[model samples]
Target: MPNAIRRYVRFIDRTNEIVGLIMMYMIFLMIGILLYSSIMKTVAIPPLWTLEMAQFVMVTYYMVGGGWALKNDAHVRMDLIYANWQPRTKALIDTVTVLFLIFYLCLLLYGGFSSTSYALKYGETSYSAWSPYMAPVKIIMCFGIALTLLQAVAQLFKDIAIARGEEIS
Candidate 1:
């Protein structure tokens, strides 16, 4: 990889790591909050933000965590045919699949950018009590899409190297 791309990949790695950490933290926080809310409600405290926070945390956890999932090759995939193929043949299939996903993610990034732009332009905010600006969160979808795209490119290069009988390790 070129220096710039290597740097970008490093950035992606850092971003993926941070996102994973945040997701884990969010999960723990949500679980703790729910427990607290349950206890408080039993005492008539009635935690109001629990429902909204849980919903937002779920979104944050999933969207932010996806790049890390892709980075670690943790996404669920069916490889019945590829499993029987030779390494070189499997590399080819993997390369093609990564390319396809690149196209798909590119579309997502484009649409996300447009939607976020519209939201920001309109000063859109959540209708709920918190009234958090929705644009920032909408933009995160684009960041995730971009990270996935980067990962796809890295995978494409890796697969090509493997198909050429190069030892990737």
Candidate 2:
């Protein structure tokens, strides 16, 4: 593989690893929020934001961790036939299938950006009582989707290299 492609793959892998590790802690934050809400409900009225805030954190957690999941091959797949394939055959197949994933992610990212833009332009907020601004979450969603898309492309390159009997890093 070329130096630039190797560097690009390494960069995307490293970036996703760091972001996913950091976001993993968000599960604890969500837990703490829910725990606080539970305790408050017993002693007094629960804060209006606790449930929704926890939900938001959960969304962020999964959204941002998606790239790492892809990089690690943690996403579920139908492996009945795939698992039996030879390494080069698997790589060849993956190279073709990842294009579909790339295309779908592109559409999702475009929609996310559009929604985020609308939120920013109109100062959109949730309909709930807390009514938090939606832009922040939308922006995060777009960022995560972009990261996942980059990871998909990186995977495609890696697959190509493998199919050609070369290894990337």
Candidate 3:
């Protein structure tokens, strides 16, 4: 592989790694919040922010972790047939599927951007008691989807190279 492409792929990988770490910390924080809230409930102190913040953190976790999962090839697939295919055949199938995925992701990215824009313009906030601004979570979601699309492109390049008899080490 050329140095530039290799570096780009490495950058994507690193981005996913960092995102995954952030997600992990977010999950830990969510757990702590829930535990504290549970303990506080025994004393008749209602922690409304705990539920709202937990929901936000959960959304961020799923969105960011999705990209990391894609980077790791951990997305769901039909293993019954795909596992039996030869490597070249698998590569071809993956390349073709990736093309469709790119199209889908393009649409998703456009829609996400539009929705995020609307949220920012309207100062959208949750309907809960906390009613925090929604723009930040929407922005994070769009960013995660964009990163996942980038990882898909990288995977397409690898699949094409593999189809062309290039050794990937």
lDDT of each: 0.77, 0.96, 0.85
Q: Write the per-residue lDDT of candidate 3 for residues 1-169, one digit (tens) a residue.
A: 7777767777887888788877878889889888888998998886788888888889888887876888788888888999999888899999999999989888999999999999999999989888889999999889878988888887787788788877443
Question: What shift in Å separates residue 106 of candidate 3 from its native position after superposition?
Answer: 1.6
Q: What is the lDDT of candidate 3?
A: 0.85
Candidate 2 lDDT by residue in tens digits, 94-124: 9999999999999999999999999999999
Candidate 1 lDDT: 0.77
> For model 3, what is the alpha-carbon lDDT of residue 34?
87
Candidate 2 CA-lDDT value: 0.96
Could you tell me the lDDT of residue 108 within candidate 2? 98
Could you list the CA RMSD of all candidates, in the order they appear?
2.7, 0.6, 1.6
User: Which stretches of candidate 2 lie above 4 Å from their native place?
Assistant: none
Per-candidate count of clashing residue pairs (backbone under 3 Å): 0, 0, 0
- Candidate 3 residues lying further than 4 Å off, grouped into runs, are 1-3
Candidate 2 to native Cα RMSD, angstroms: 0.6
Candidates 1 and 3 compared by TM-score, better number: 3
Candidate 1 residue-wise lDDT, 84-168, digit = tens: 8999998888989888899998888889999999999999988887677788778776776776777677677667878988743
TM-score of each: 0.80, 0.98, 0.92
C-alpha RMSD of candidate 1: 2.7
What candidate 1 gets wrong by more than 4 Å, as runs, is: 1-18, 45-48
Q: Give the lowest summed-lDDT range of ten residues in model 1.
A: 1-10
Instruction: Give the clash total for candidate 2.
Output: 0
Q: What TM-score should be assigned to candidate 3?
A: 0.92
